[model samples]
Target: MGHQYGKKGEELVFWNSQKQAVVSNWIDVEDHKFEPPALELISELLTKPRNGLAPDLAVVAKAEAQLAKVLDVYEARLAEFKYLAADNYTIADVLHLPNLQALMETPAKKLIESRARVSAWCSEILARPAWAKVVEMKLKAHA
Candidate 1:
């Protein structure tokens, strides 16, 4: 599946005995095509400085600017629709679950929380019982 659909395939897939694989690749492409740049920017902002050197404030600012632009795009779309693709939940929203969960604990949390609709969407998704079980399992495993 990964070879066939790349990272999007690796993210989420539904397969049945009929050999049909319902994939999220198209939704991923349409919804997240502009995300790599924001991801790269976040990576640059979060990576530690090496060799006892100080973090570059200028570079961090640039990355924040880039991320802000990406967030603006998301905010606009989310204002109109409850989810990325439509009003209903789908693989498109599911694909973002983990990343958004992680970001909630990071410096970039505001990227999601600052937008009203995006924040509401995240709250609704994160409140699901399945996600709560996943978090519980992760905590128990670490303990």
Candidate 2:
């Protein structure tokens, strides 16, 4: 992932101004609208080592277990309710999809596949035109 502290993603995904002295002086620290999702993702991906492609087996198992707890929470909530936070998409969905897909490659896949709404949520995100395009490009690039 190589997502070090200073780097630029595409304009839409990040605003990496490098925090140069001049640029830092000109920007208002509190005037930001959205903190970049790609920055967050990059941080997460970098922290995990190898974009988490080589996660420790125990770590993956533990994460799967931790996420099972979350899925249970969401599933229980959805048994009588609907989506997480809102019924429509938001930045959370965008941030989460990559991880969910990654986890789906591990033990969490069984849990996600078995959960009805979670499965539907995964399907919805993966099915979107833009999201699919991004996935296709990332996959084609083998990132």
Candidate 3:
């Protein structure tokens, strides 16, 4: 099994029979491959400077533009389906959980909430007990 400590000190591993590896610091894993927009978003967020420390407005704007493109794709798909992979929630939707939770608290939140379908989808996912439990554990750990 492939296992290691990620940059943020999170444990990363390849799980399941398919040997899916954890991607970035998000609680997402796939079978040695990533579906689009998810893979693209992960790469964009990881490569850019953290929100507050970005050197100038241009950098932030550029990042936002890139993120917008990805979000547009998500919004369009969500408009027709309950989840990214269709009606059933799958790894594709699971992969967005952590990142979306964080994004909901940031200025970019409007980018999601402004889109009706995306907002509804986020609400449904965030309300899941599994996600709630994860949030509880994270809060307690920080406390």
Query: Root-mean-square deviation of each candidate, in angstroms?
Result: 6.7, 11.7, 8.5
lDDT, candidates in the order shown: 0.61, 0.50, 0.59
Writing each residue's lDDT as its tens digit, candidate 3 over 1-143 gives 11433223322333343423212222232222222433344334443445433334554456567667766766787777776654655555666777777666556677778888878988999998978999999999999
Per-residue lDDT tens digits for candidate 2, residues 54-129, read 4355544554565566666657745653444334343334555666555545444676789898787777776778
User: Could you tell me which residue pairs clash in candidate 2?
Assistant: none
lDDT of 1: 0.61
Error of 1 at 6 (Å): 20
The better-scoring model by lDDT among 1 and 3 is 1
Q: In terms of lDDT, which candidate is stronger, 2 or 3?
A: 3
- Rank order (by lDDT, best first): 1, 3, 2
After superposition, candidate 3 runs with Cα above 4 Å error: 1-55
